[model samples]
Target: KSVGLNQVILRYASDKHERIYGMGEQYSSLEHKGKRIPIITAEQGIGRGKQPVTFAFNRVFMGSGGNWHTTYTAIPHYVTSAARSVFLTNYSYAEFDFTDDETISILSTTPTNTLCGQIIGARSIPETVAAYTEYSGRMEPLPEWAYANGVILGMTGGSAKVRKVASMLRDAGVPLAGLWLQDWGGIRNTSIGIERVWWNWELDESNYPDWHALREEAAMNGTRLLTYTNPFLMDARGPKGRLYREAKEAGYMVQTVAGGVYRLGHEPGVSFGLLDLTNPAAVRWIEDVLHDMLKNTGAVGWMADFGEYLPFDCVLHSGEAPIAVHNRYPEDWAALNRRAMIRAGLGSKNEGGNGEGMFYSRSASSQTPRHTPLMWLGDQLVSWDAHDGMKSAVLGMLQGGLSGLALSHSDIGGYTATPGRHRTRELLMRWMELSALSDVVFRTHQGNRPLHNAQPWDTPELLDHLRDFARLHRALAPYRAELMRESSLTGMPLTRPLFMHYPHDVVASRVATQFLVGRDILAAPVMDRKTSRVHVYLPPGDTWLDVWTTQQAPAQPTGPRHGHGVWLTVDAPMGWPAVFIR
Candidate 1:
């Protein structure tokens, strides 16, 4: 063993017929056999948009060839078709080798002793997840309003603009539940134009002069508020920066091995200091900041962002090296927000408390689901390709559910569009149709550039579809809530892969384009643009009814109306997602 590092390789014999799943959020295929997965969280560019768009601060460059496997979240846990499961309990980067037919090996390097846990008698995926959650923790129930669709309005517009948008949604008769305000605090200019680099946890009164009034207006409209927050603090040398100075004096900021603050350079000329959450004083410092935001702003929650960049050579107040702290950083970030929310009298589901609180995050580890309830798929491009486009998001949702992210969503219509190019009406509608059927909250965001926004009311046709989906989401709230409760109690995801239920159906195991919401409803969203019909494989042993058309199709041993494992090419008209009930 090396001085600050211990490497362990665990191997097990496997059968040739075994199917494996998990390794957190993978876009390429749900089954993870014969693949090498690196457990690291970093932003690999948003694959390929129609035009060239670059965000250097995030390491996104102008390129057509994209890396779809680069992810913001990872869980080093898996369940095999052989009725066995494995979980790497340590928080460190590791390489998983599942390519060998006879042997599965996991090589991990960490500062702490390697500890892995295995589950026996895991006959199915759901059972494995339940056992894992018992060792970790289960999620809490989200507020009722979060089950509906939401729209992301970038923070550039002043408080008045938010009110105007809220009014627009109400006038348009759209059932809106949440409004996402990203970087409401402020922004700074970096080499890649302007980005949200300001670290002051307080809202920018200059842009939001009537911030309190805006919150009251949103509450009146029955909408919950979610703002953005990261775990970084800008240079403490700036005037009126009490947060930085206090953290520095209290020895709460992460330091390099040379005894300097561990800083990150987002661009050529901008840098920010990282918070050392391992320190008890530092945890209290960050919690106080969040508590003040909740008490003053009337905000219910935040979009916890950027927990993936802890330096491996840094030192912590707990004296643990970065290898032991890197992957666990996201869990710490989640804990910091959750504790602060609870301390401020905002908890999940009110549990005899005063208020309900929630936070949707992009980066998380194996235990994050136990702390935060909702998860949003990280940034995506506005493309239709199955690799990194809207369809890939469907695959992500399915994988995330099996891995225990019960409530998950993606940026509707994508979040990175080419500058000077507009997102087409058809593209947004297609994405909306898919988002409408998924188990996650349907939310839209203006990409990196403020001008290139995915506003649903762009066209009359688009607005009509958006309003319809919002209504549908609200109508299904009761059913969604039931599924959420089940998820919380059993640690199973609200959404499930088709094979999870029809395990014997060979075709269901290979179908990744469609998914089952809860237990009975099946959602098969049209993946390609301009496609009017989709092929669906109805699993055997049940009579399924089409939700769009109340026609009954029998699946084996019931009637000769439809054959077992019948593949139907159903018409999926524009603005409609192909759905069925079992």
Candidate 2:
């Protein structure tokens, strides 16, 4: 019922002991049973309500550091312990209340009165997840090379720096899949980092005077080049900002309530306008721009980023209520990127692994999966803190899997940083251990401020550590390839919670922090600093083989076998994590 203008309240009966999970890409514990999750797409705040740090960051950055429920991708859907799921299709502002033990309440502010969805059921938890994904839609597989290669190293600045580092890594024998240059267009020294310019889309000739030649060289070295992009076109006025002026003159920009161009950003030259996707002309213009860029540069892919900043008060060219179109913006954005790739002859009709170029995004909702086959957990703080860092990426994959985001990864070693929160060599190595198992494409980021964080090439030990993991990841290519085939055909997530495999084992069903990679491997990455021992729960279905255990008592089967599951502690020193093959 409507409690006020454009608002409706919804409630559903729930089992008293139901353990609910899923709210796409959340940085929290796997269960949301007693939590309040706001279903809105935006920048994930710093700290994420984690403590004294959150307080300081909130006071300074005005809550941009984020809280537990703050997510780039939040869907109005969930799966419970009983193996049932449902998804709401509403795009308006909404929140999920699991505070009540026997009921789930959703309060959503929308332009309409109806809140609708479909209840999904199957024989088991995995089957139910499959059913839910089938009902929604399955994202296609990424190109085969994504799984076949080693790590995609993140770097910035200009072509000179990239070439220098790439040569160094090549000399170091680090297996290279791709190089992610987020500053291909140009760069700006911000309070955050040496981030690229917000307005420029064209390649900065000054930065990459040898662009075409570099692409050819990288390709010859078996490395694909990836760039970065977002939805906003910063409203700069001059010959340099031709696209912005042209878009405005063609009426492709979203408008203010008073009917002038709506601009956003806290600083000058940073403020920008969004392309009104509702306008077919605007959609065509941006897609064509993207298509031409990809083809001309011979770039295999790019990061299709930031679709969460659309304003609910802006006016679209199609005359639709902004509030009604808000949450669906990410879906539209992904679809547009997909169309652009397809237009450039980089799309596959059957399976997605046909060397079809791919893009990854950070925003999603109910329908965002089918279009955005690749999703990355948004920027994480450069700390080991679980609320918004390495540990949070674990939750991101577990929870994101339940929501049909089959291919997900995080910026290795984390991204965001403040004064005190910085990356350490220990943190970077430990974060890589966590990622080596869960992510589809092993990738790293230099963080918002590269000056504050440690990169893979920061130290000799870090470089050797990266090389070890890269070799291990490459060795798993055949296994991962099969996993991808399964994910593409069956909608079964590549990273999954334990309950899906050991449903009858009560203790195993609730285990967090550890997850399954496909149906055979169980990974337990250490989530804390200054720890060499990791406690792991071995599920009942199979007797596990330890991959790498050192300097500790052999793991013993302990506790009452809850369907034969038991606990074991093992040595997991730096660079070595607990991974079991079942």
Candidate 3:
């Protein structure tokens, strides 16, 4: 009866009226029924492009997953409008078929697998999330330190320039939480120019001569210090690159199936090695390295980068096959960092409950929220499009909320490389407006280019809007804390789709641009450039108030009792966002 060697297929029936939601982060409709969902993760670069060949090859290379919309994270979970939810526990290649309106079929790529799934019968979606969180772990609330605006400088800048930039932000009246020194890691050269390499985990002593003293000074200015960390190690020839040599000698690196250490070539560093965190000893080694870095630089936390690098043809120290552990790699990497932080006495609620310790990540899976506190929308292009711009971010957050990552954010001005030009002032301001009203933490990054950093100081026209929106974000603190508390106690996302609230409302079910922030406030950030007005749909059964103008919009004009909504075209200039409360 077996048709395939390592494939397991699942089939089930679904009511015609039931609608499905949840599949990690996808750019599809809010209602996921009648769709074929591939549960795989890959490095799907920035936005939609003409390079279909590249995307298609990566999709095949990655085994399974959506080619265009799916990115670094994938959670095999879904909730139905019938008050039923299903959580697939498998982490390997799998496909979900909801096309049969009457049936749901799933095919797992690995055989001899136990067909295990958690089905919950809840009264509502929120309740379903609560059950899911109880099964996985609940996400903790972010501390006040994380609420402020942040900036990441480019690689050309040294310690003094960084200090100057921090001062510039303060002088410009920008409320800054911290200055993220991304280039603090060792420097290198790629096709682009001098860049920071991922492999060398140590500070570049030449660039940051007084690293310890400068970090202490920056801390005094209320600007906390943060750095970046990834799993790649550059070649072993660099005089200061001891991590590579040591990891290989101790058998702490991932080995190719043929034997010997596995190496790969990439940008910034012509070639590099990978750290196999599946090896307990390797995890310990990384923890020690991070502890040393924290002690030396007085940094409060780090940016845990690049966990989506597990190869299908590689070896692991845990003795588990690569196919079995590939999809769960990000969650494991998060746990490794979490343990490292705890060992360094900088864990979340380690010393006191002030929420002092945290790390920002871009890669995740279903178990990621249990170990990580925050996840940012990965490197996005500097354009306004559905693929990787404001629209994608909005949908991504809503999807992430459904996936159980309540604490999320995006690069404020975008992070993709654009030749000869930085993000326009209009784009930056519009993005700032979006970040202001959303539940995601606010942060900025200089796109990947060497010297092309997007700084608010460069555009004097945006200073007022930037400062005002930051104040707006701070003003929403109390309400945001309430949302975080609910997320911590239960598993509801901070920002979820309108359909989650008005499931029966026909309009709300299809509106992905609008979302509810903690049940009362609705944020519809302008995703178009130079747009002055945005249409909003007010769900039936409640009178909605425009928070900006203090005016109420009447309920639905007509339709099935609870399935109706009123549409309102509201004014939304470049710097203003469309937000309402009910």
User: What TM-score, computed on C-alpha atoms, does each candidate reach?
Assistant: 0.91, 0.94, 0.92
Compared to the true structure, candidate 3 yields what TM-score? 0.92
Q: Which stretches of candidate 3 lie over 4 Å from their true place?
A: 1-5, 48-66, 148-156, 192-195, 350-354, 418-422, 450-453, 557-560
**Per-residue alpha-carbon lDDT of candidate 3 for residues 1-582, written as tens digits (9 for 90 to 100):** 555468778887799888888787775446777788787765646444424433653454443223454677777888876558888777887888888888999888774355566888887778888888786687788766777444332223678887776676677777777777787865555575534554577888887888888877877776677788877777757656678888888988889988888887644346677788788889889878877777677777678887777888899888788887878888888888877667666766744433566788788888888888888777666667776556777777787777778888787777765444467778878888888777456677766664565556676677666677777887787788888889989888888888777776667778888788888998888878888999988888788898879998886544346447778899987766888888
Tens-place lDDT per residue, model 1, 428-447, is 78788777778457677766
lDDT of each: 0.74, 0.81, 0.74
Residue 23 CA displacement from its true place in model 3, Å: 0.8
lDDT for 452 (candidate 3): 61
**What is the descending TM-score order?**
2, 3, 1
The residue pairs that clash in candidate 3, if any, are 199-233, 199-234
Find the candidate with the highest TM-score and give its number: 2
* Least well predicted 10-residue stretch by lDDT in candidate 3: 57-66
Note the residue pairs that clash in candidate 2. 45-65, 45-66, 46-64, 46-65, 46-66, 48-66, 48-67
Model 2's lDDT to the true fold?
0.81
What is the lDDT, from 0 to 100, of the residue 195 in candidate 1?
48
The runs of at least 3 residues in candidate 1 whose Cα sits more than 4 Å from the true structure, single-residue gaps closed, are: 1-5, 48-68, 148-156, 188-190, 194-197, 236-242, 349-352, 419-422, 557-564
lDDT of 3 at 410: 82
